[model samples]
Target: MVTFQFIPFQEIENLGSAKRVNKLLNIVKENKIVLMEGRLKKQEEADLIEITMEEISPKFKGIELSVVYPNKSKQDFGQKVKGTFANLLLGDRQGMTIIGPASVVKRIEQNPNKIELFTKEAKTPPAKRYRKKK
Candidate 1:
């Protein structure tokens, strides 16, 4: 069995509107993988959250966990499924998290034909111009 933590992006509401955008930026820096909904709250607040894996809960049917980066948070009932996640935390700012348990992972792994990765070697850049003298 497996369990997952559900993180919503609207928790920043409590922070007030002025720092909403700033808070979102900070969250991006902290978590490597995150799904952000660009929409702001009524008071104009963005929702940003990070998801991490954990041990399965026998009482729970699917992964249903909630965590607050600072204050407290709560989730609704009956919303957890099983599946696999291949870099579920893709660097994309807007996207839904696909939850899959062991079965899904195994099936994809065993498939003969699979999607190939498309990427090329990255190039390094030179230092920027600077003028600091006395």
Candidate 2:
């Protein structure tokens, strides 16, 4: 079965960049999808990918990550200013971040209005059979 873990922004707000990335990676490695409250900084995202690459193996393939944030291009000047102030004061808690194990999460697709997460089918090993000996 697929599992999802929700991490609140406050949980990682105080963690260092490395720690935050590690925390997310650890979860993904366990085949669990992480639904993070807010997006990571660009630098942090890059670091996460770099680290993930280094840790890739036969069992731990990698991670599928995506961030869904609001589009500010169409916002008015006043709204943009308010958003900037909010971000400055409340940190970058404006979007959702999704991180999942690459083995389980095939791909993540996003559109302006929605997101689609495709997952791989779970394979079950065949049961062993025993025969009586004479």
* TM-score of every candidate relative to the true structure: 0.24, 0.87
C-alpha lDDT (0 to 100) for residue 2 of candidate 2 = 90
Writing each residue's lDDT as its tens digit, candidate 1 over 12-127 gives: 43555556545543333332222333234323321222221222234212221111121112322322111112114421223233222322122212123332222223344888
Clash tally, candidates in order: 6, 0
Among all candidates shown, the one with the greatest lDDT: 2
Q: Which ten residues in a row have the lowest lDDT in candidate 2?
A: 86-95
Residues 1-134 of candidate 2 have per-residue lDDT tens digits of 89999999999999999999999999888889999998999999999999999999888999999999877887899999998998888776889999999999999999887899999988988888888897
Looking at model 2, residue 127 earns an lDDT score of 86
Superposed model 2: Cα runs more than 4 Å off:
124-134
Alpha-carbon local distance difference test for all models? 0.30, 0.93
lDDT of model 2 at position 115: 95
- Best candidate according to TM-score: 2
Query: Any residue pairs clashing in model 1, and if so which?
Result: 9-47, 9-48, 41-45, 83-100, 83-101, 84-100
* Local distance difference test, candidate 2: 0.93
